[model samples]
Target: MQSELIHDSDFGRYLEDFKEGMVIRHWPGKTITESDNNLFSLLTMNHHPVHLDQHYASEATHGQVLVVGTLVFSLAVGLTVREISGRAIANLNYSEVLHHSPVFIGDTIYAESQILSVRSSRSKPDRGVIKVKTTVTNQKGEKVLSFLREVLIPKKN
Candidate 1:
């Protein structure tokens, strides 16, 4: 069967679609490279040795270069936007951010998000709060990072 193509703007979803415990796995994982770490660290003005200096990183706990935590977090969030929050009104906040393990160059990362809770906004009848737990894992199925975030989503009229 042929599937119809749905444009981003034309695809609208209701709050009920984001039910609690619903898990959305983002496909086409990204492979982290040496250049990615270096560029991300420099772009963010984070000159930390763990991410920028290979020699220094070799002596650290992991004995290798580490990907910046923020970069991983941003990538995870970016991966979910298309499927989860393409039409979101606003991102409320992030909580429970944890760096469970270090990410190294050449590692592939995949993202999964679980809807945690939802609540109707009192002031905004057309919007509601959607809380989700996002996790980034490597090819080995090891979770390297995770966080909880909430966003305001428009309700179906």
Candidate 2:
């Protein structure tokens, strides 16, 4: 007996569906909150006074608690997953990660990604490698983070 394969249509796009220069705007931006910063910091073992202690942050340059960088990076990448890498077999690499501005509590983060390149895998014929550049902006239209990521996506037969 032979088994059939199934692909979830709602998951994400296949490699063959992606095109160079394609741009995707991720929906439903995320709002940074005090609890978000606190929990993310504590859970990650990031004991940064600026991200946890409001009292200390008040005296700091930003004059308030600053959100952790990893938190921002995590959310930024997460926002692009559905449209970019949700169906990926593996994340090949992440590069050129830059945090351009600070993310504070009450800030809503929105993300958009542009396809950079695509290539069929030499060792694998059933999948292709895709590269994309994602930029994360705040509600105020300020760029907060940007990065490049490469993923391997299965080709539909």
Best of the candidates, TM-score? 2
Candidate 1 deviant stretches above 4 angstroms:
1-12
Per-residue CA lDDT of model 2 for 84-129, tens digit only, reads 7889999989999999998888999988888889889999899999
Model 1, 109-150: lDDT tens digits are 988888889889989898898998988999899999999999
Error of 1 at 112 (Å): 0.9
Backbone Cα, N, C clashes tallied per candidate: 0, 0
Off by over 4 Å in 2: 1-9
Residue pairs clashing in model 1 are none
Error of 1 at 10 (Å): 6.9
